[model samples]
Target: MSNKKKERKLAKKLLHKYRLVILNEDTFEERFAIKLTRLNVFVLTSISAILLIILTTLLIAFTPLREYIPGYASTSLKRKANELNTKTDSLQKAMLMNERYLASIKSVLTGEVKTEDFNRDSILKAARQDIDFSQVLPNRQDSLLREKVDKEDKYNLFEDNNTANFVLFPPVNGAISEAYNLEEKHYAVDIVVPVDTPVKATADGTVIFAEWTMETGYVMIIEHSQELISVYKHNASLTKTQGDLVKAGEVIAMAGNSGQFSTGPHLHFELWSKGYPVNPTNFIDFE
Candidate 1:
């Protein structure tokens, strides 16, 4: 056999051994090859899909994505919030009272009102006649009588009599901002002092009043012999109480800006004998 023919036959045998074949027919033939098992592919695809779903769920549940969900408010939490609000409101009111008391003190010291005629009730009545409740009381006779007696007694004790011997310092060392007068209806002397200064008793007396007031803040009223009464107003705090005996120059209170009519730290000192307002400066030597 010829060498070329032998080589051609050997090549054809090698192609047949490897299952490589060429068709001579003119018709097309369909061919298919399997790469993987159907069951295996399906199982892997299902597992991947499940893992994606789980990851997405975890992100939504544990991350900021959860914020999209509306959270329900608890009644207990709401109640607590309301209570806090109420407390805050009360504190604010107290602060406002302190501010006003201080302002009133400043006004008195600056001569806004006459010390001799400064009547807190009368001023309130005149300025707020529309809101006056004095006339609406069930039994105003007692109130009127008491007021009248108080005024008369104060006037007589300070003006008509000279019974008390103990002199007093009108206020702690501070400028006399306001003086006593009767024409303008101012009935007290105002002394401007630093906040928290000590307020001393003008004379030996028993404390008749020591309490927080809307207009005067913390007030201390002392009654001495011969119907003499001294009023200390707008105290930040009181060291003495009602019925407590206090001596002249004794520390009775700490100066404060507490009251509804005060503007700053000061002592609104008033002297009364019998029942009327008296000039505190007359008895106190500021120099």
Candidate 2:
């Protein structure tokens, strides 16, 4: 019975009404007045607080202001990060391929390549085996064009060579011990000379490679203009280091029979054009 009486009393206090009034301070006049219950005031304040909280949450979630908060990332920033990751992967793959290519070139320069017994001409001929050469004939227009071109070139003295203005110099003057033979896979000419003979550069270029190896002894490679490259092997000593600029006919090394492949004191010289081995005798007159 006592608990029921206390509950009734609390309800009466919560339902009780109070008058709130505002008056002019000097005139003592009642300007505003309102009758409000305790329950009504509490309900109104609670509703206003809830509405303010919801508005604040919507503003942060639906607008760009969210990105300024901690642990929030912008959309454009994520896209740029993904693009950079893709580019980094591509660059890594390209760098790996370049390293492999450089390793192959190093092996060739060090004389670590294995000789193959196939002829390049034979392979090309085999590829054309199905074609009938007798059936192939030049048409009238083609023949006329060829004749006109020949006539124009017949009297022309200034023929444009693809080597630009570069002239090749003989590295050493000696009897050829071994000529370049495609069938034997010997792409370089071996010039027999006494040990410690001076080996000169063939053209104006920069030394790209200079090192010693077990199979080729002291080897030096130069990169020239016009897509030309010259290689000197079986050298007794190299006078210039890699990245050194050299002139035509400059002494770069001394020839010696210092490698496992050397028969005697000779300079194994090779010339390359556009990455293919070319006959050195075709460019420079050694004798």
What C-alpha lDDT do the candidate models reach, one value each? 0.75, 0.86
Query: Residue by residue across 1-287, what tens digits does model 1's lDDT show?
Result: 69999998775654442323454457645354334444456677999999999999999777766656679455566899999999999999999997886675454433354335467898877878666678766477888998887876652334444644446655587887777767766688788899999999888899877888787798888888777778888899999988799888899999989988997888888877665567877567654
Weakest lDDT window of 10 consecutive positions for candidate 1: 14-23
What's model 1's TM-score? 0.44
TM-score of each model, in listed order: 0.44, 0.54
The per-residue C-alpha lDDT of model 2 at residue 119 equals 92
Q: Once superposed on the true structure, which residue ranges of model 2 sit more than 4 Å away at CA? A: 1-98, 110-164
Say which candidate scores most in lDDT.
2
Off by over 4 Å in 1: 1-165
In candidate 2, the residue pairs with backbone N, CA or C atoms under 3 Å apart (3 or more residues apart, or in different chains) clash, namely: none
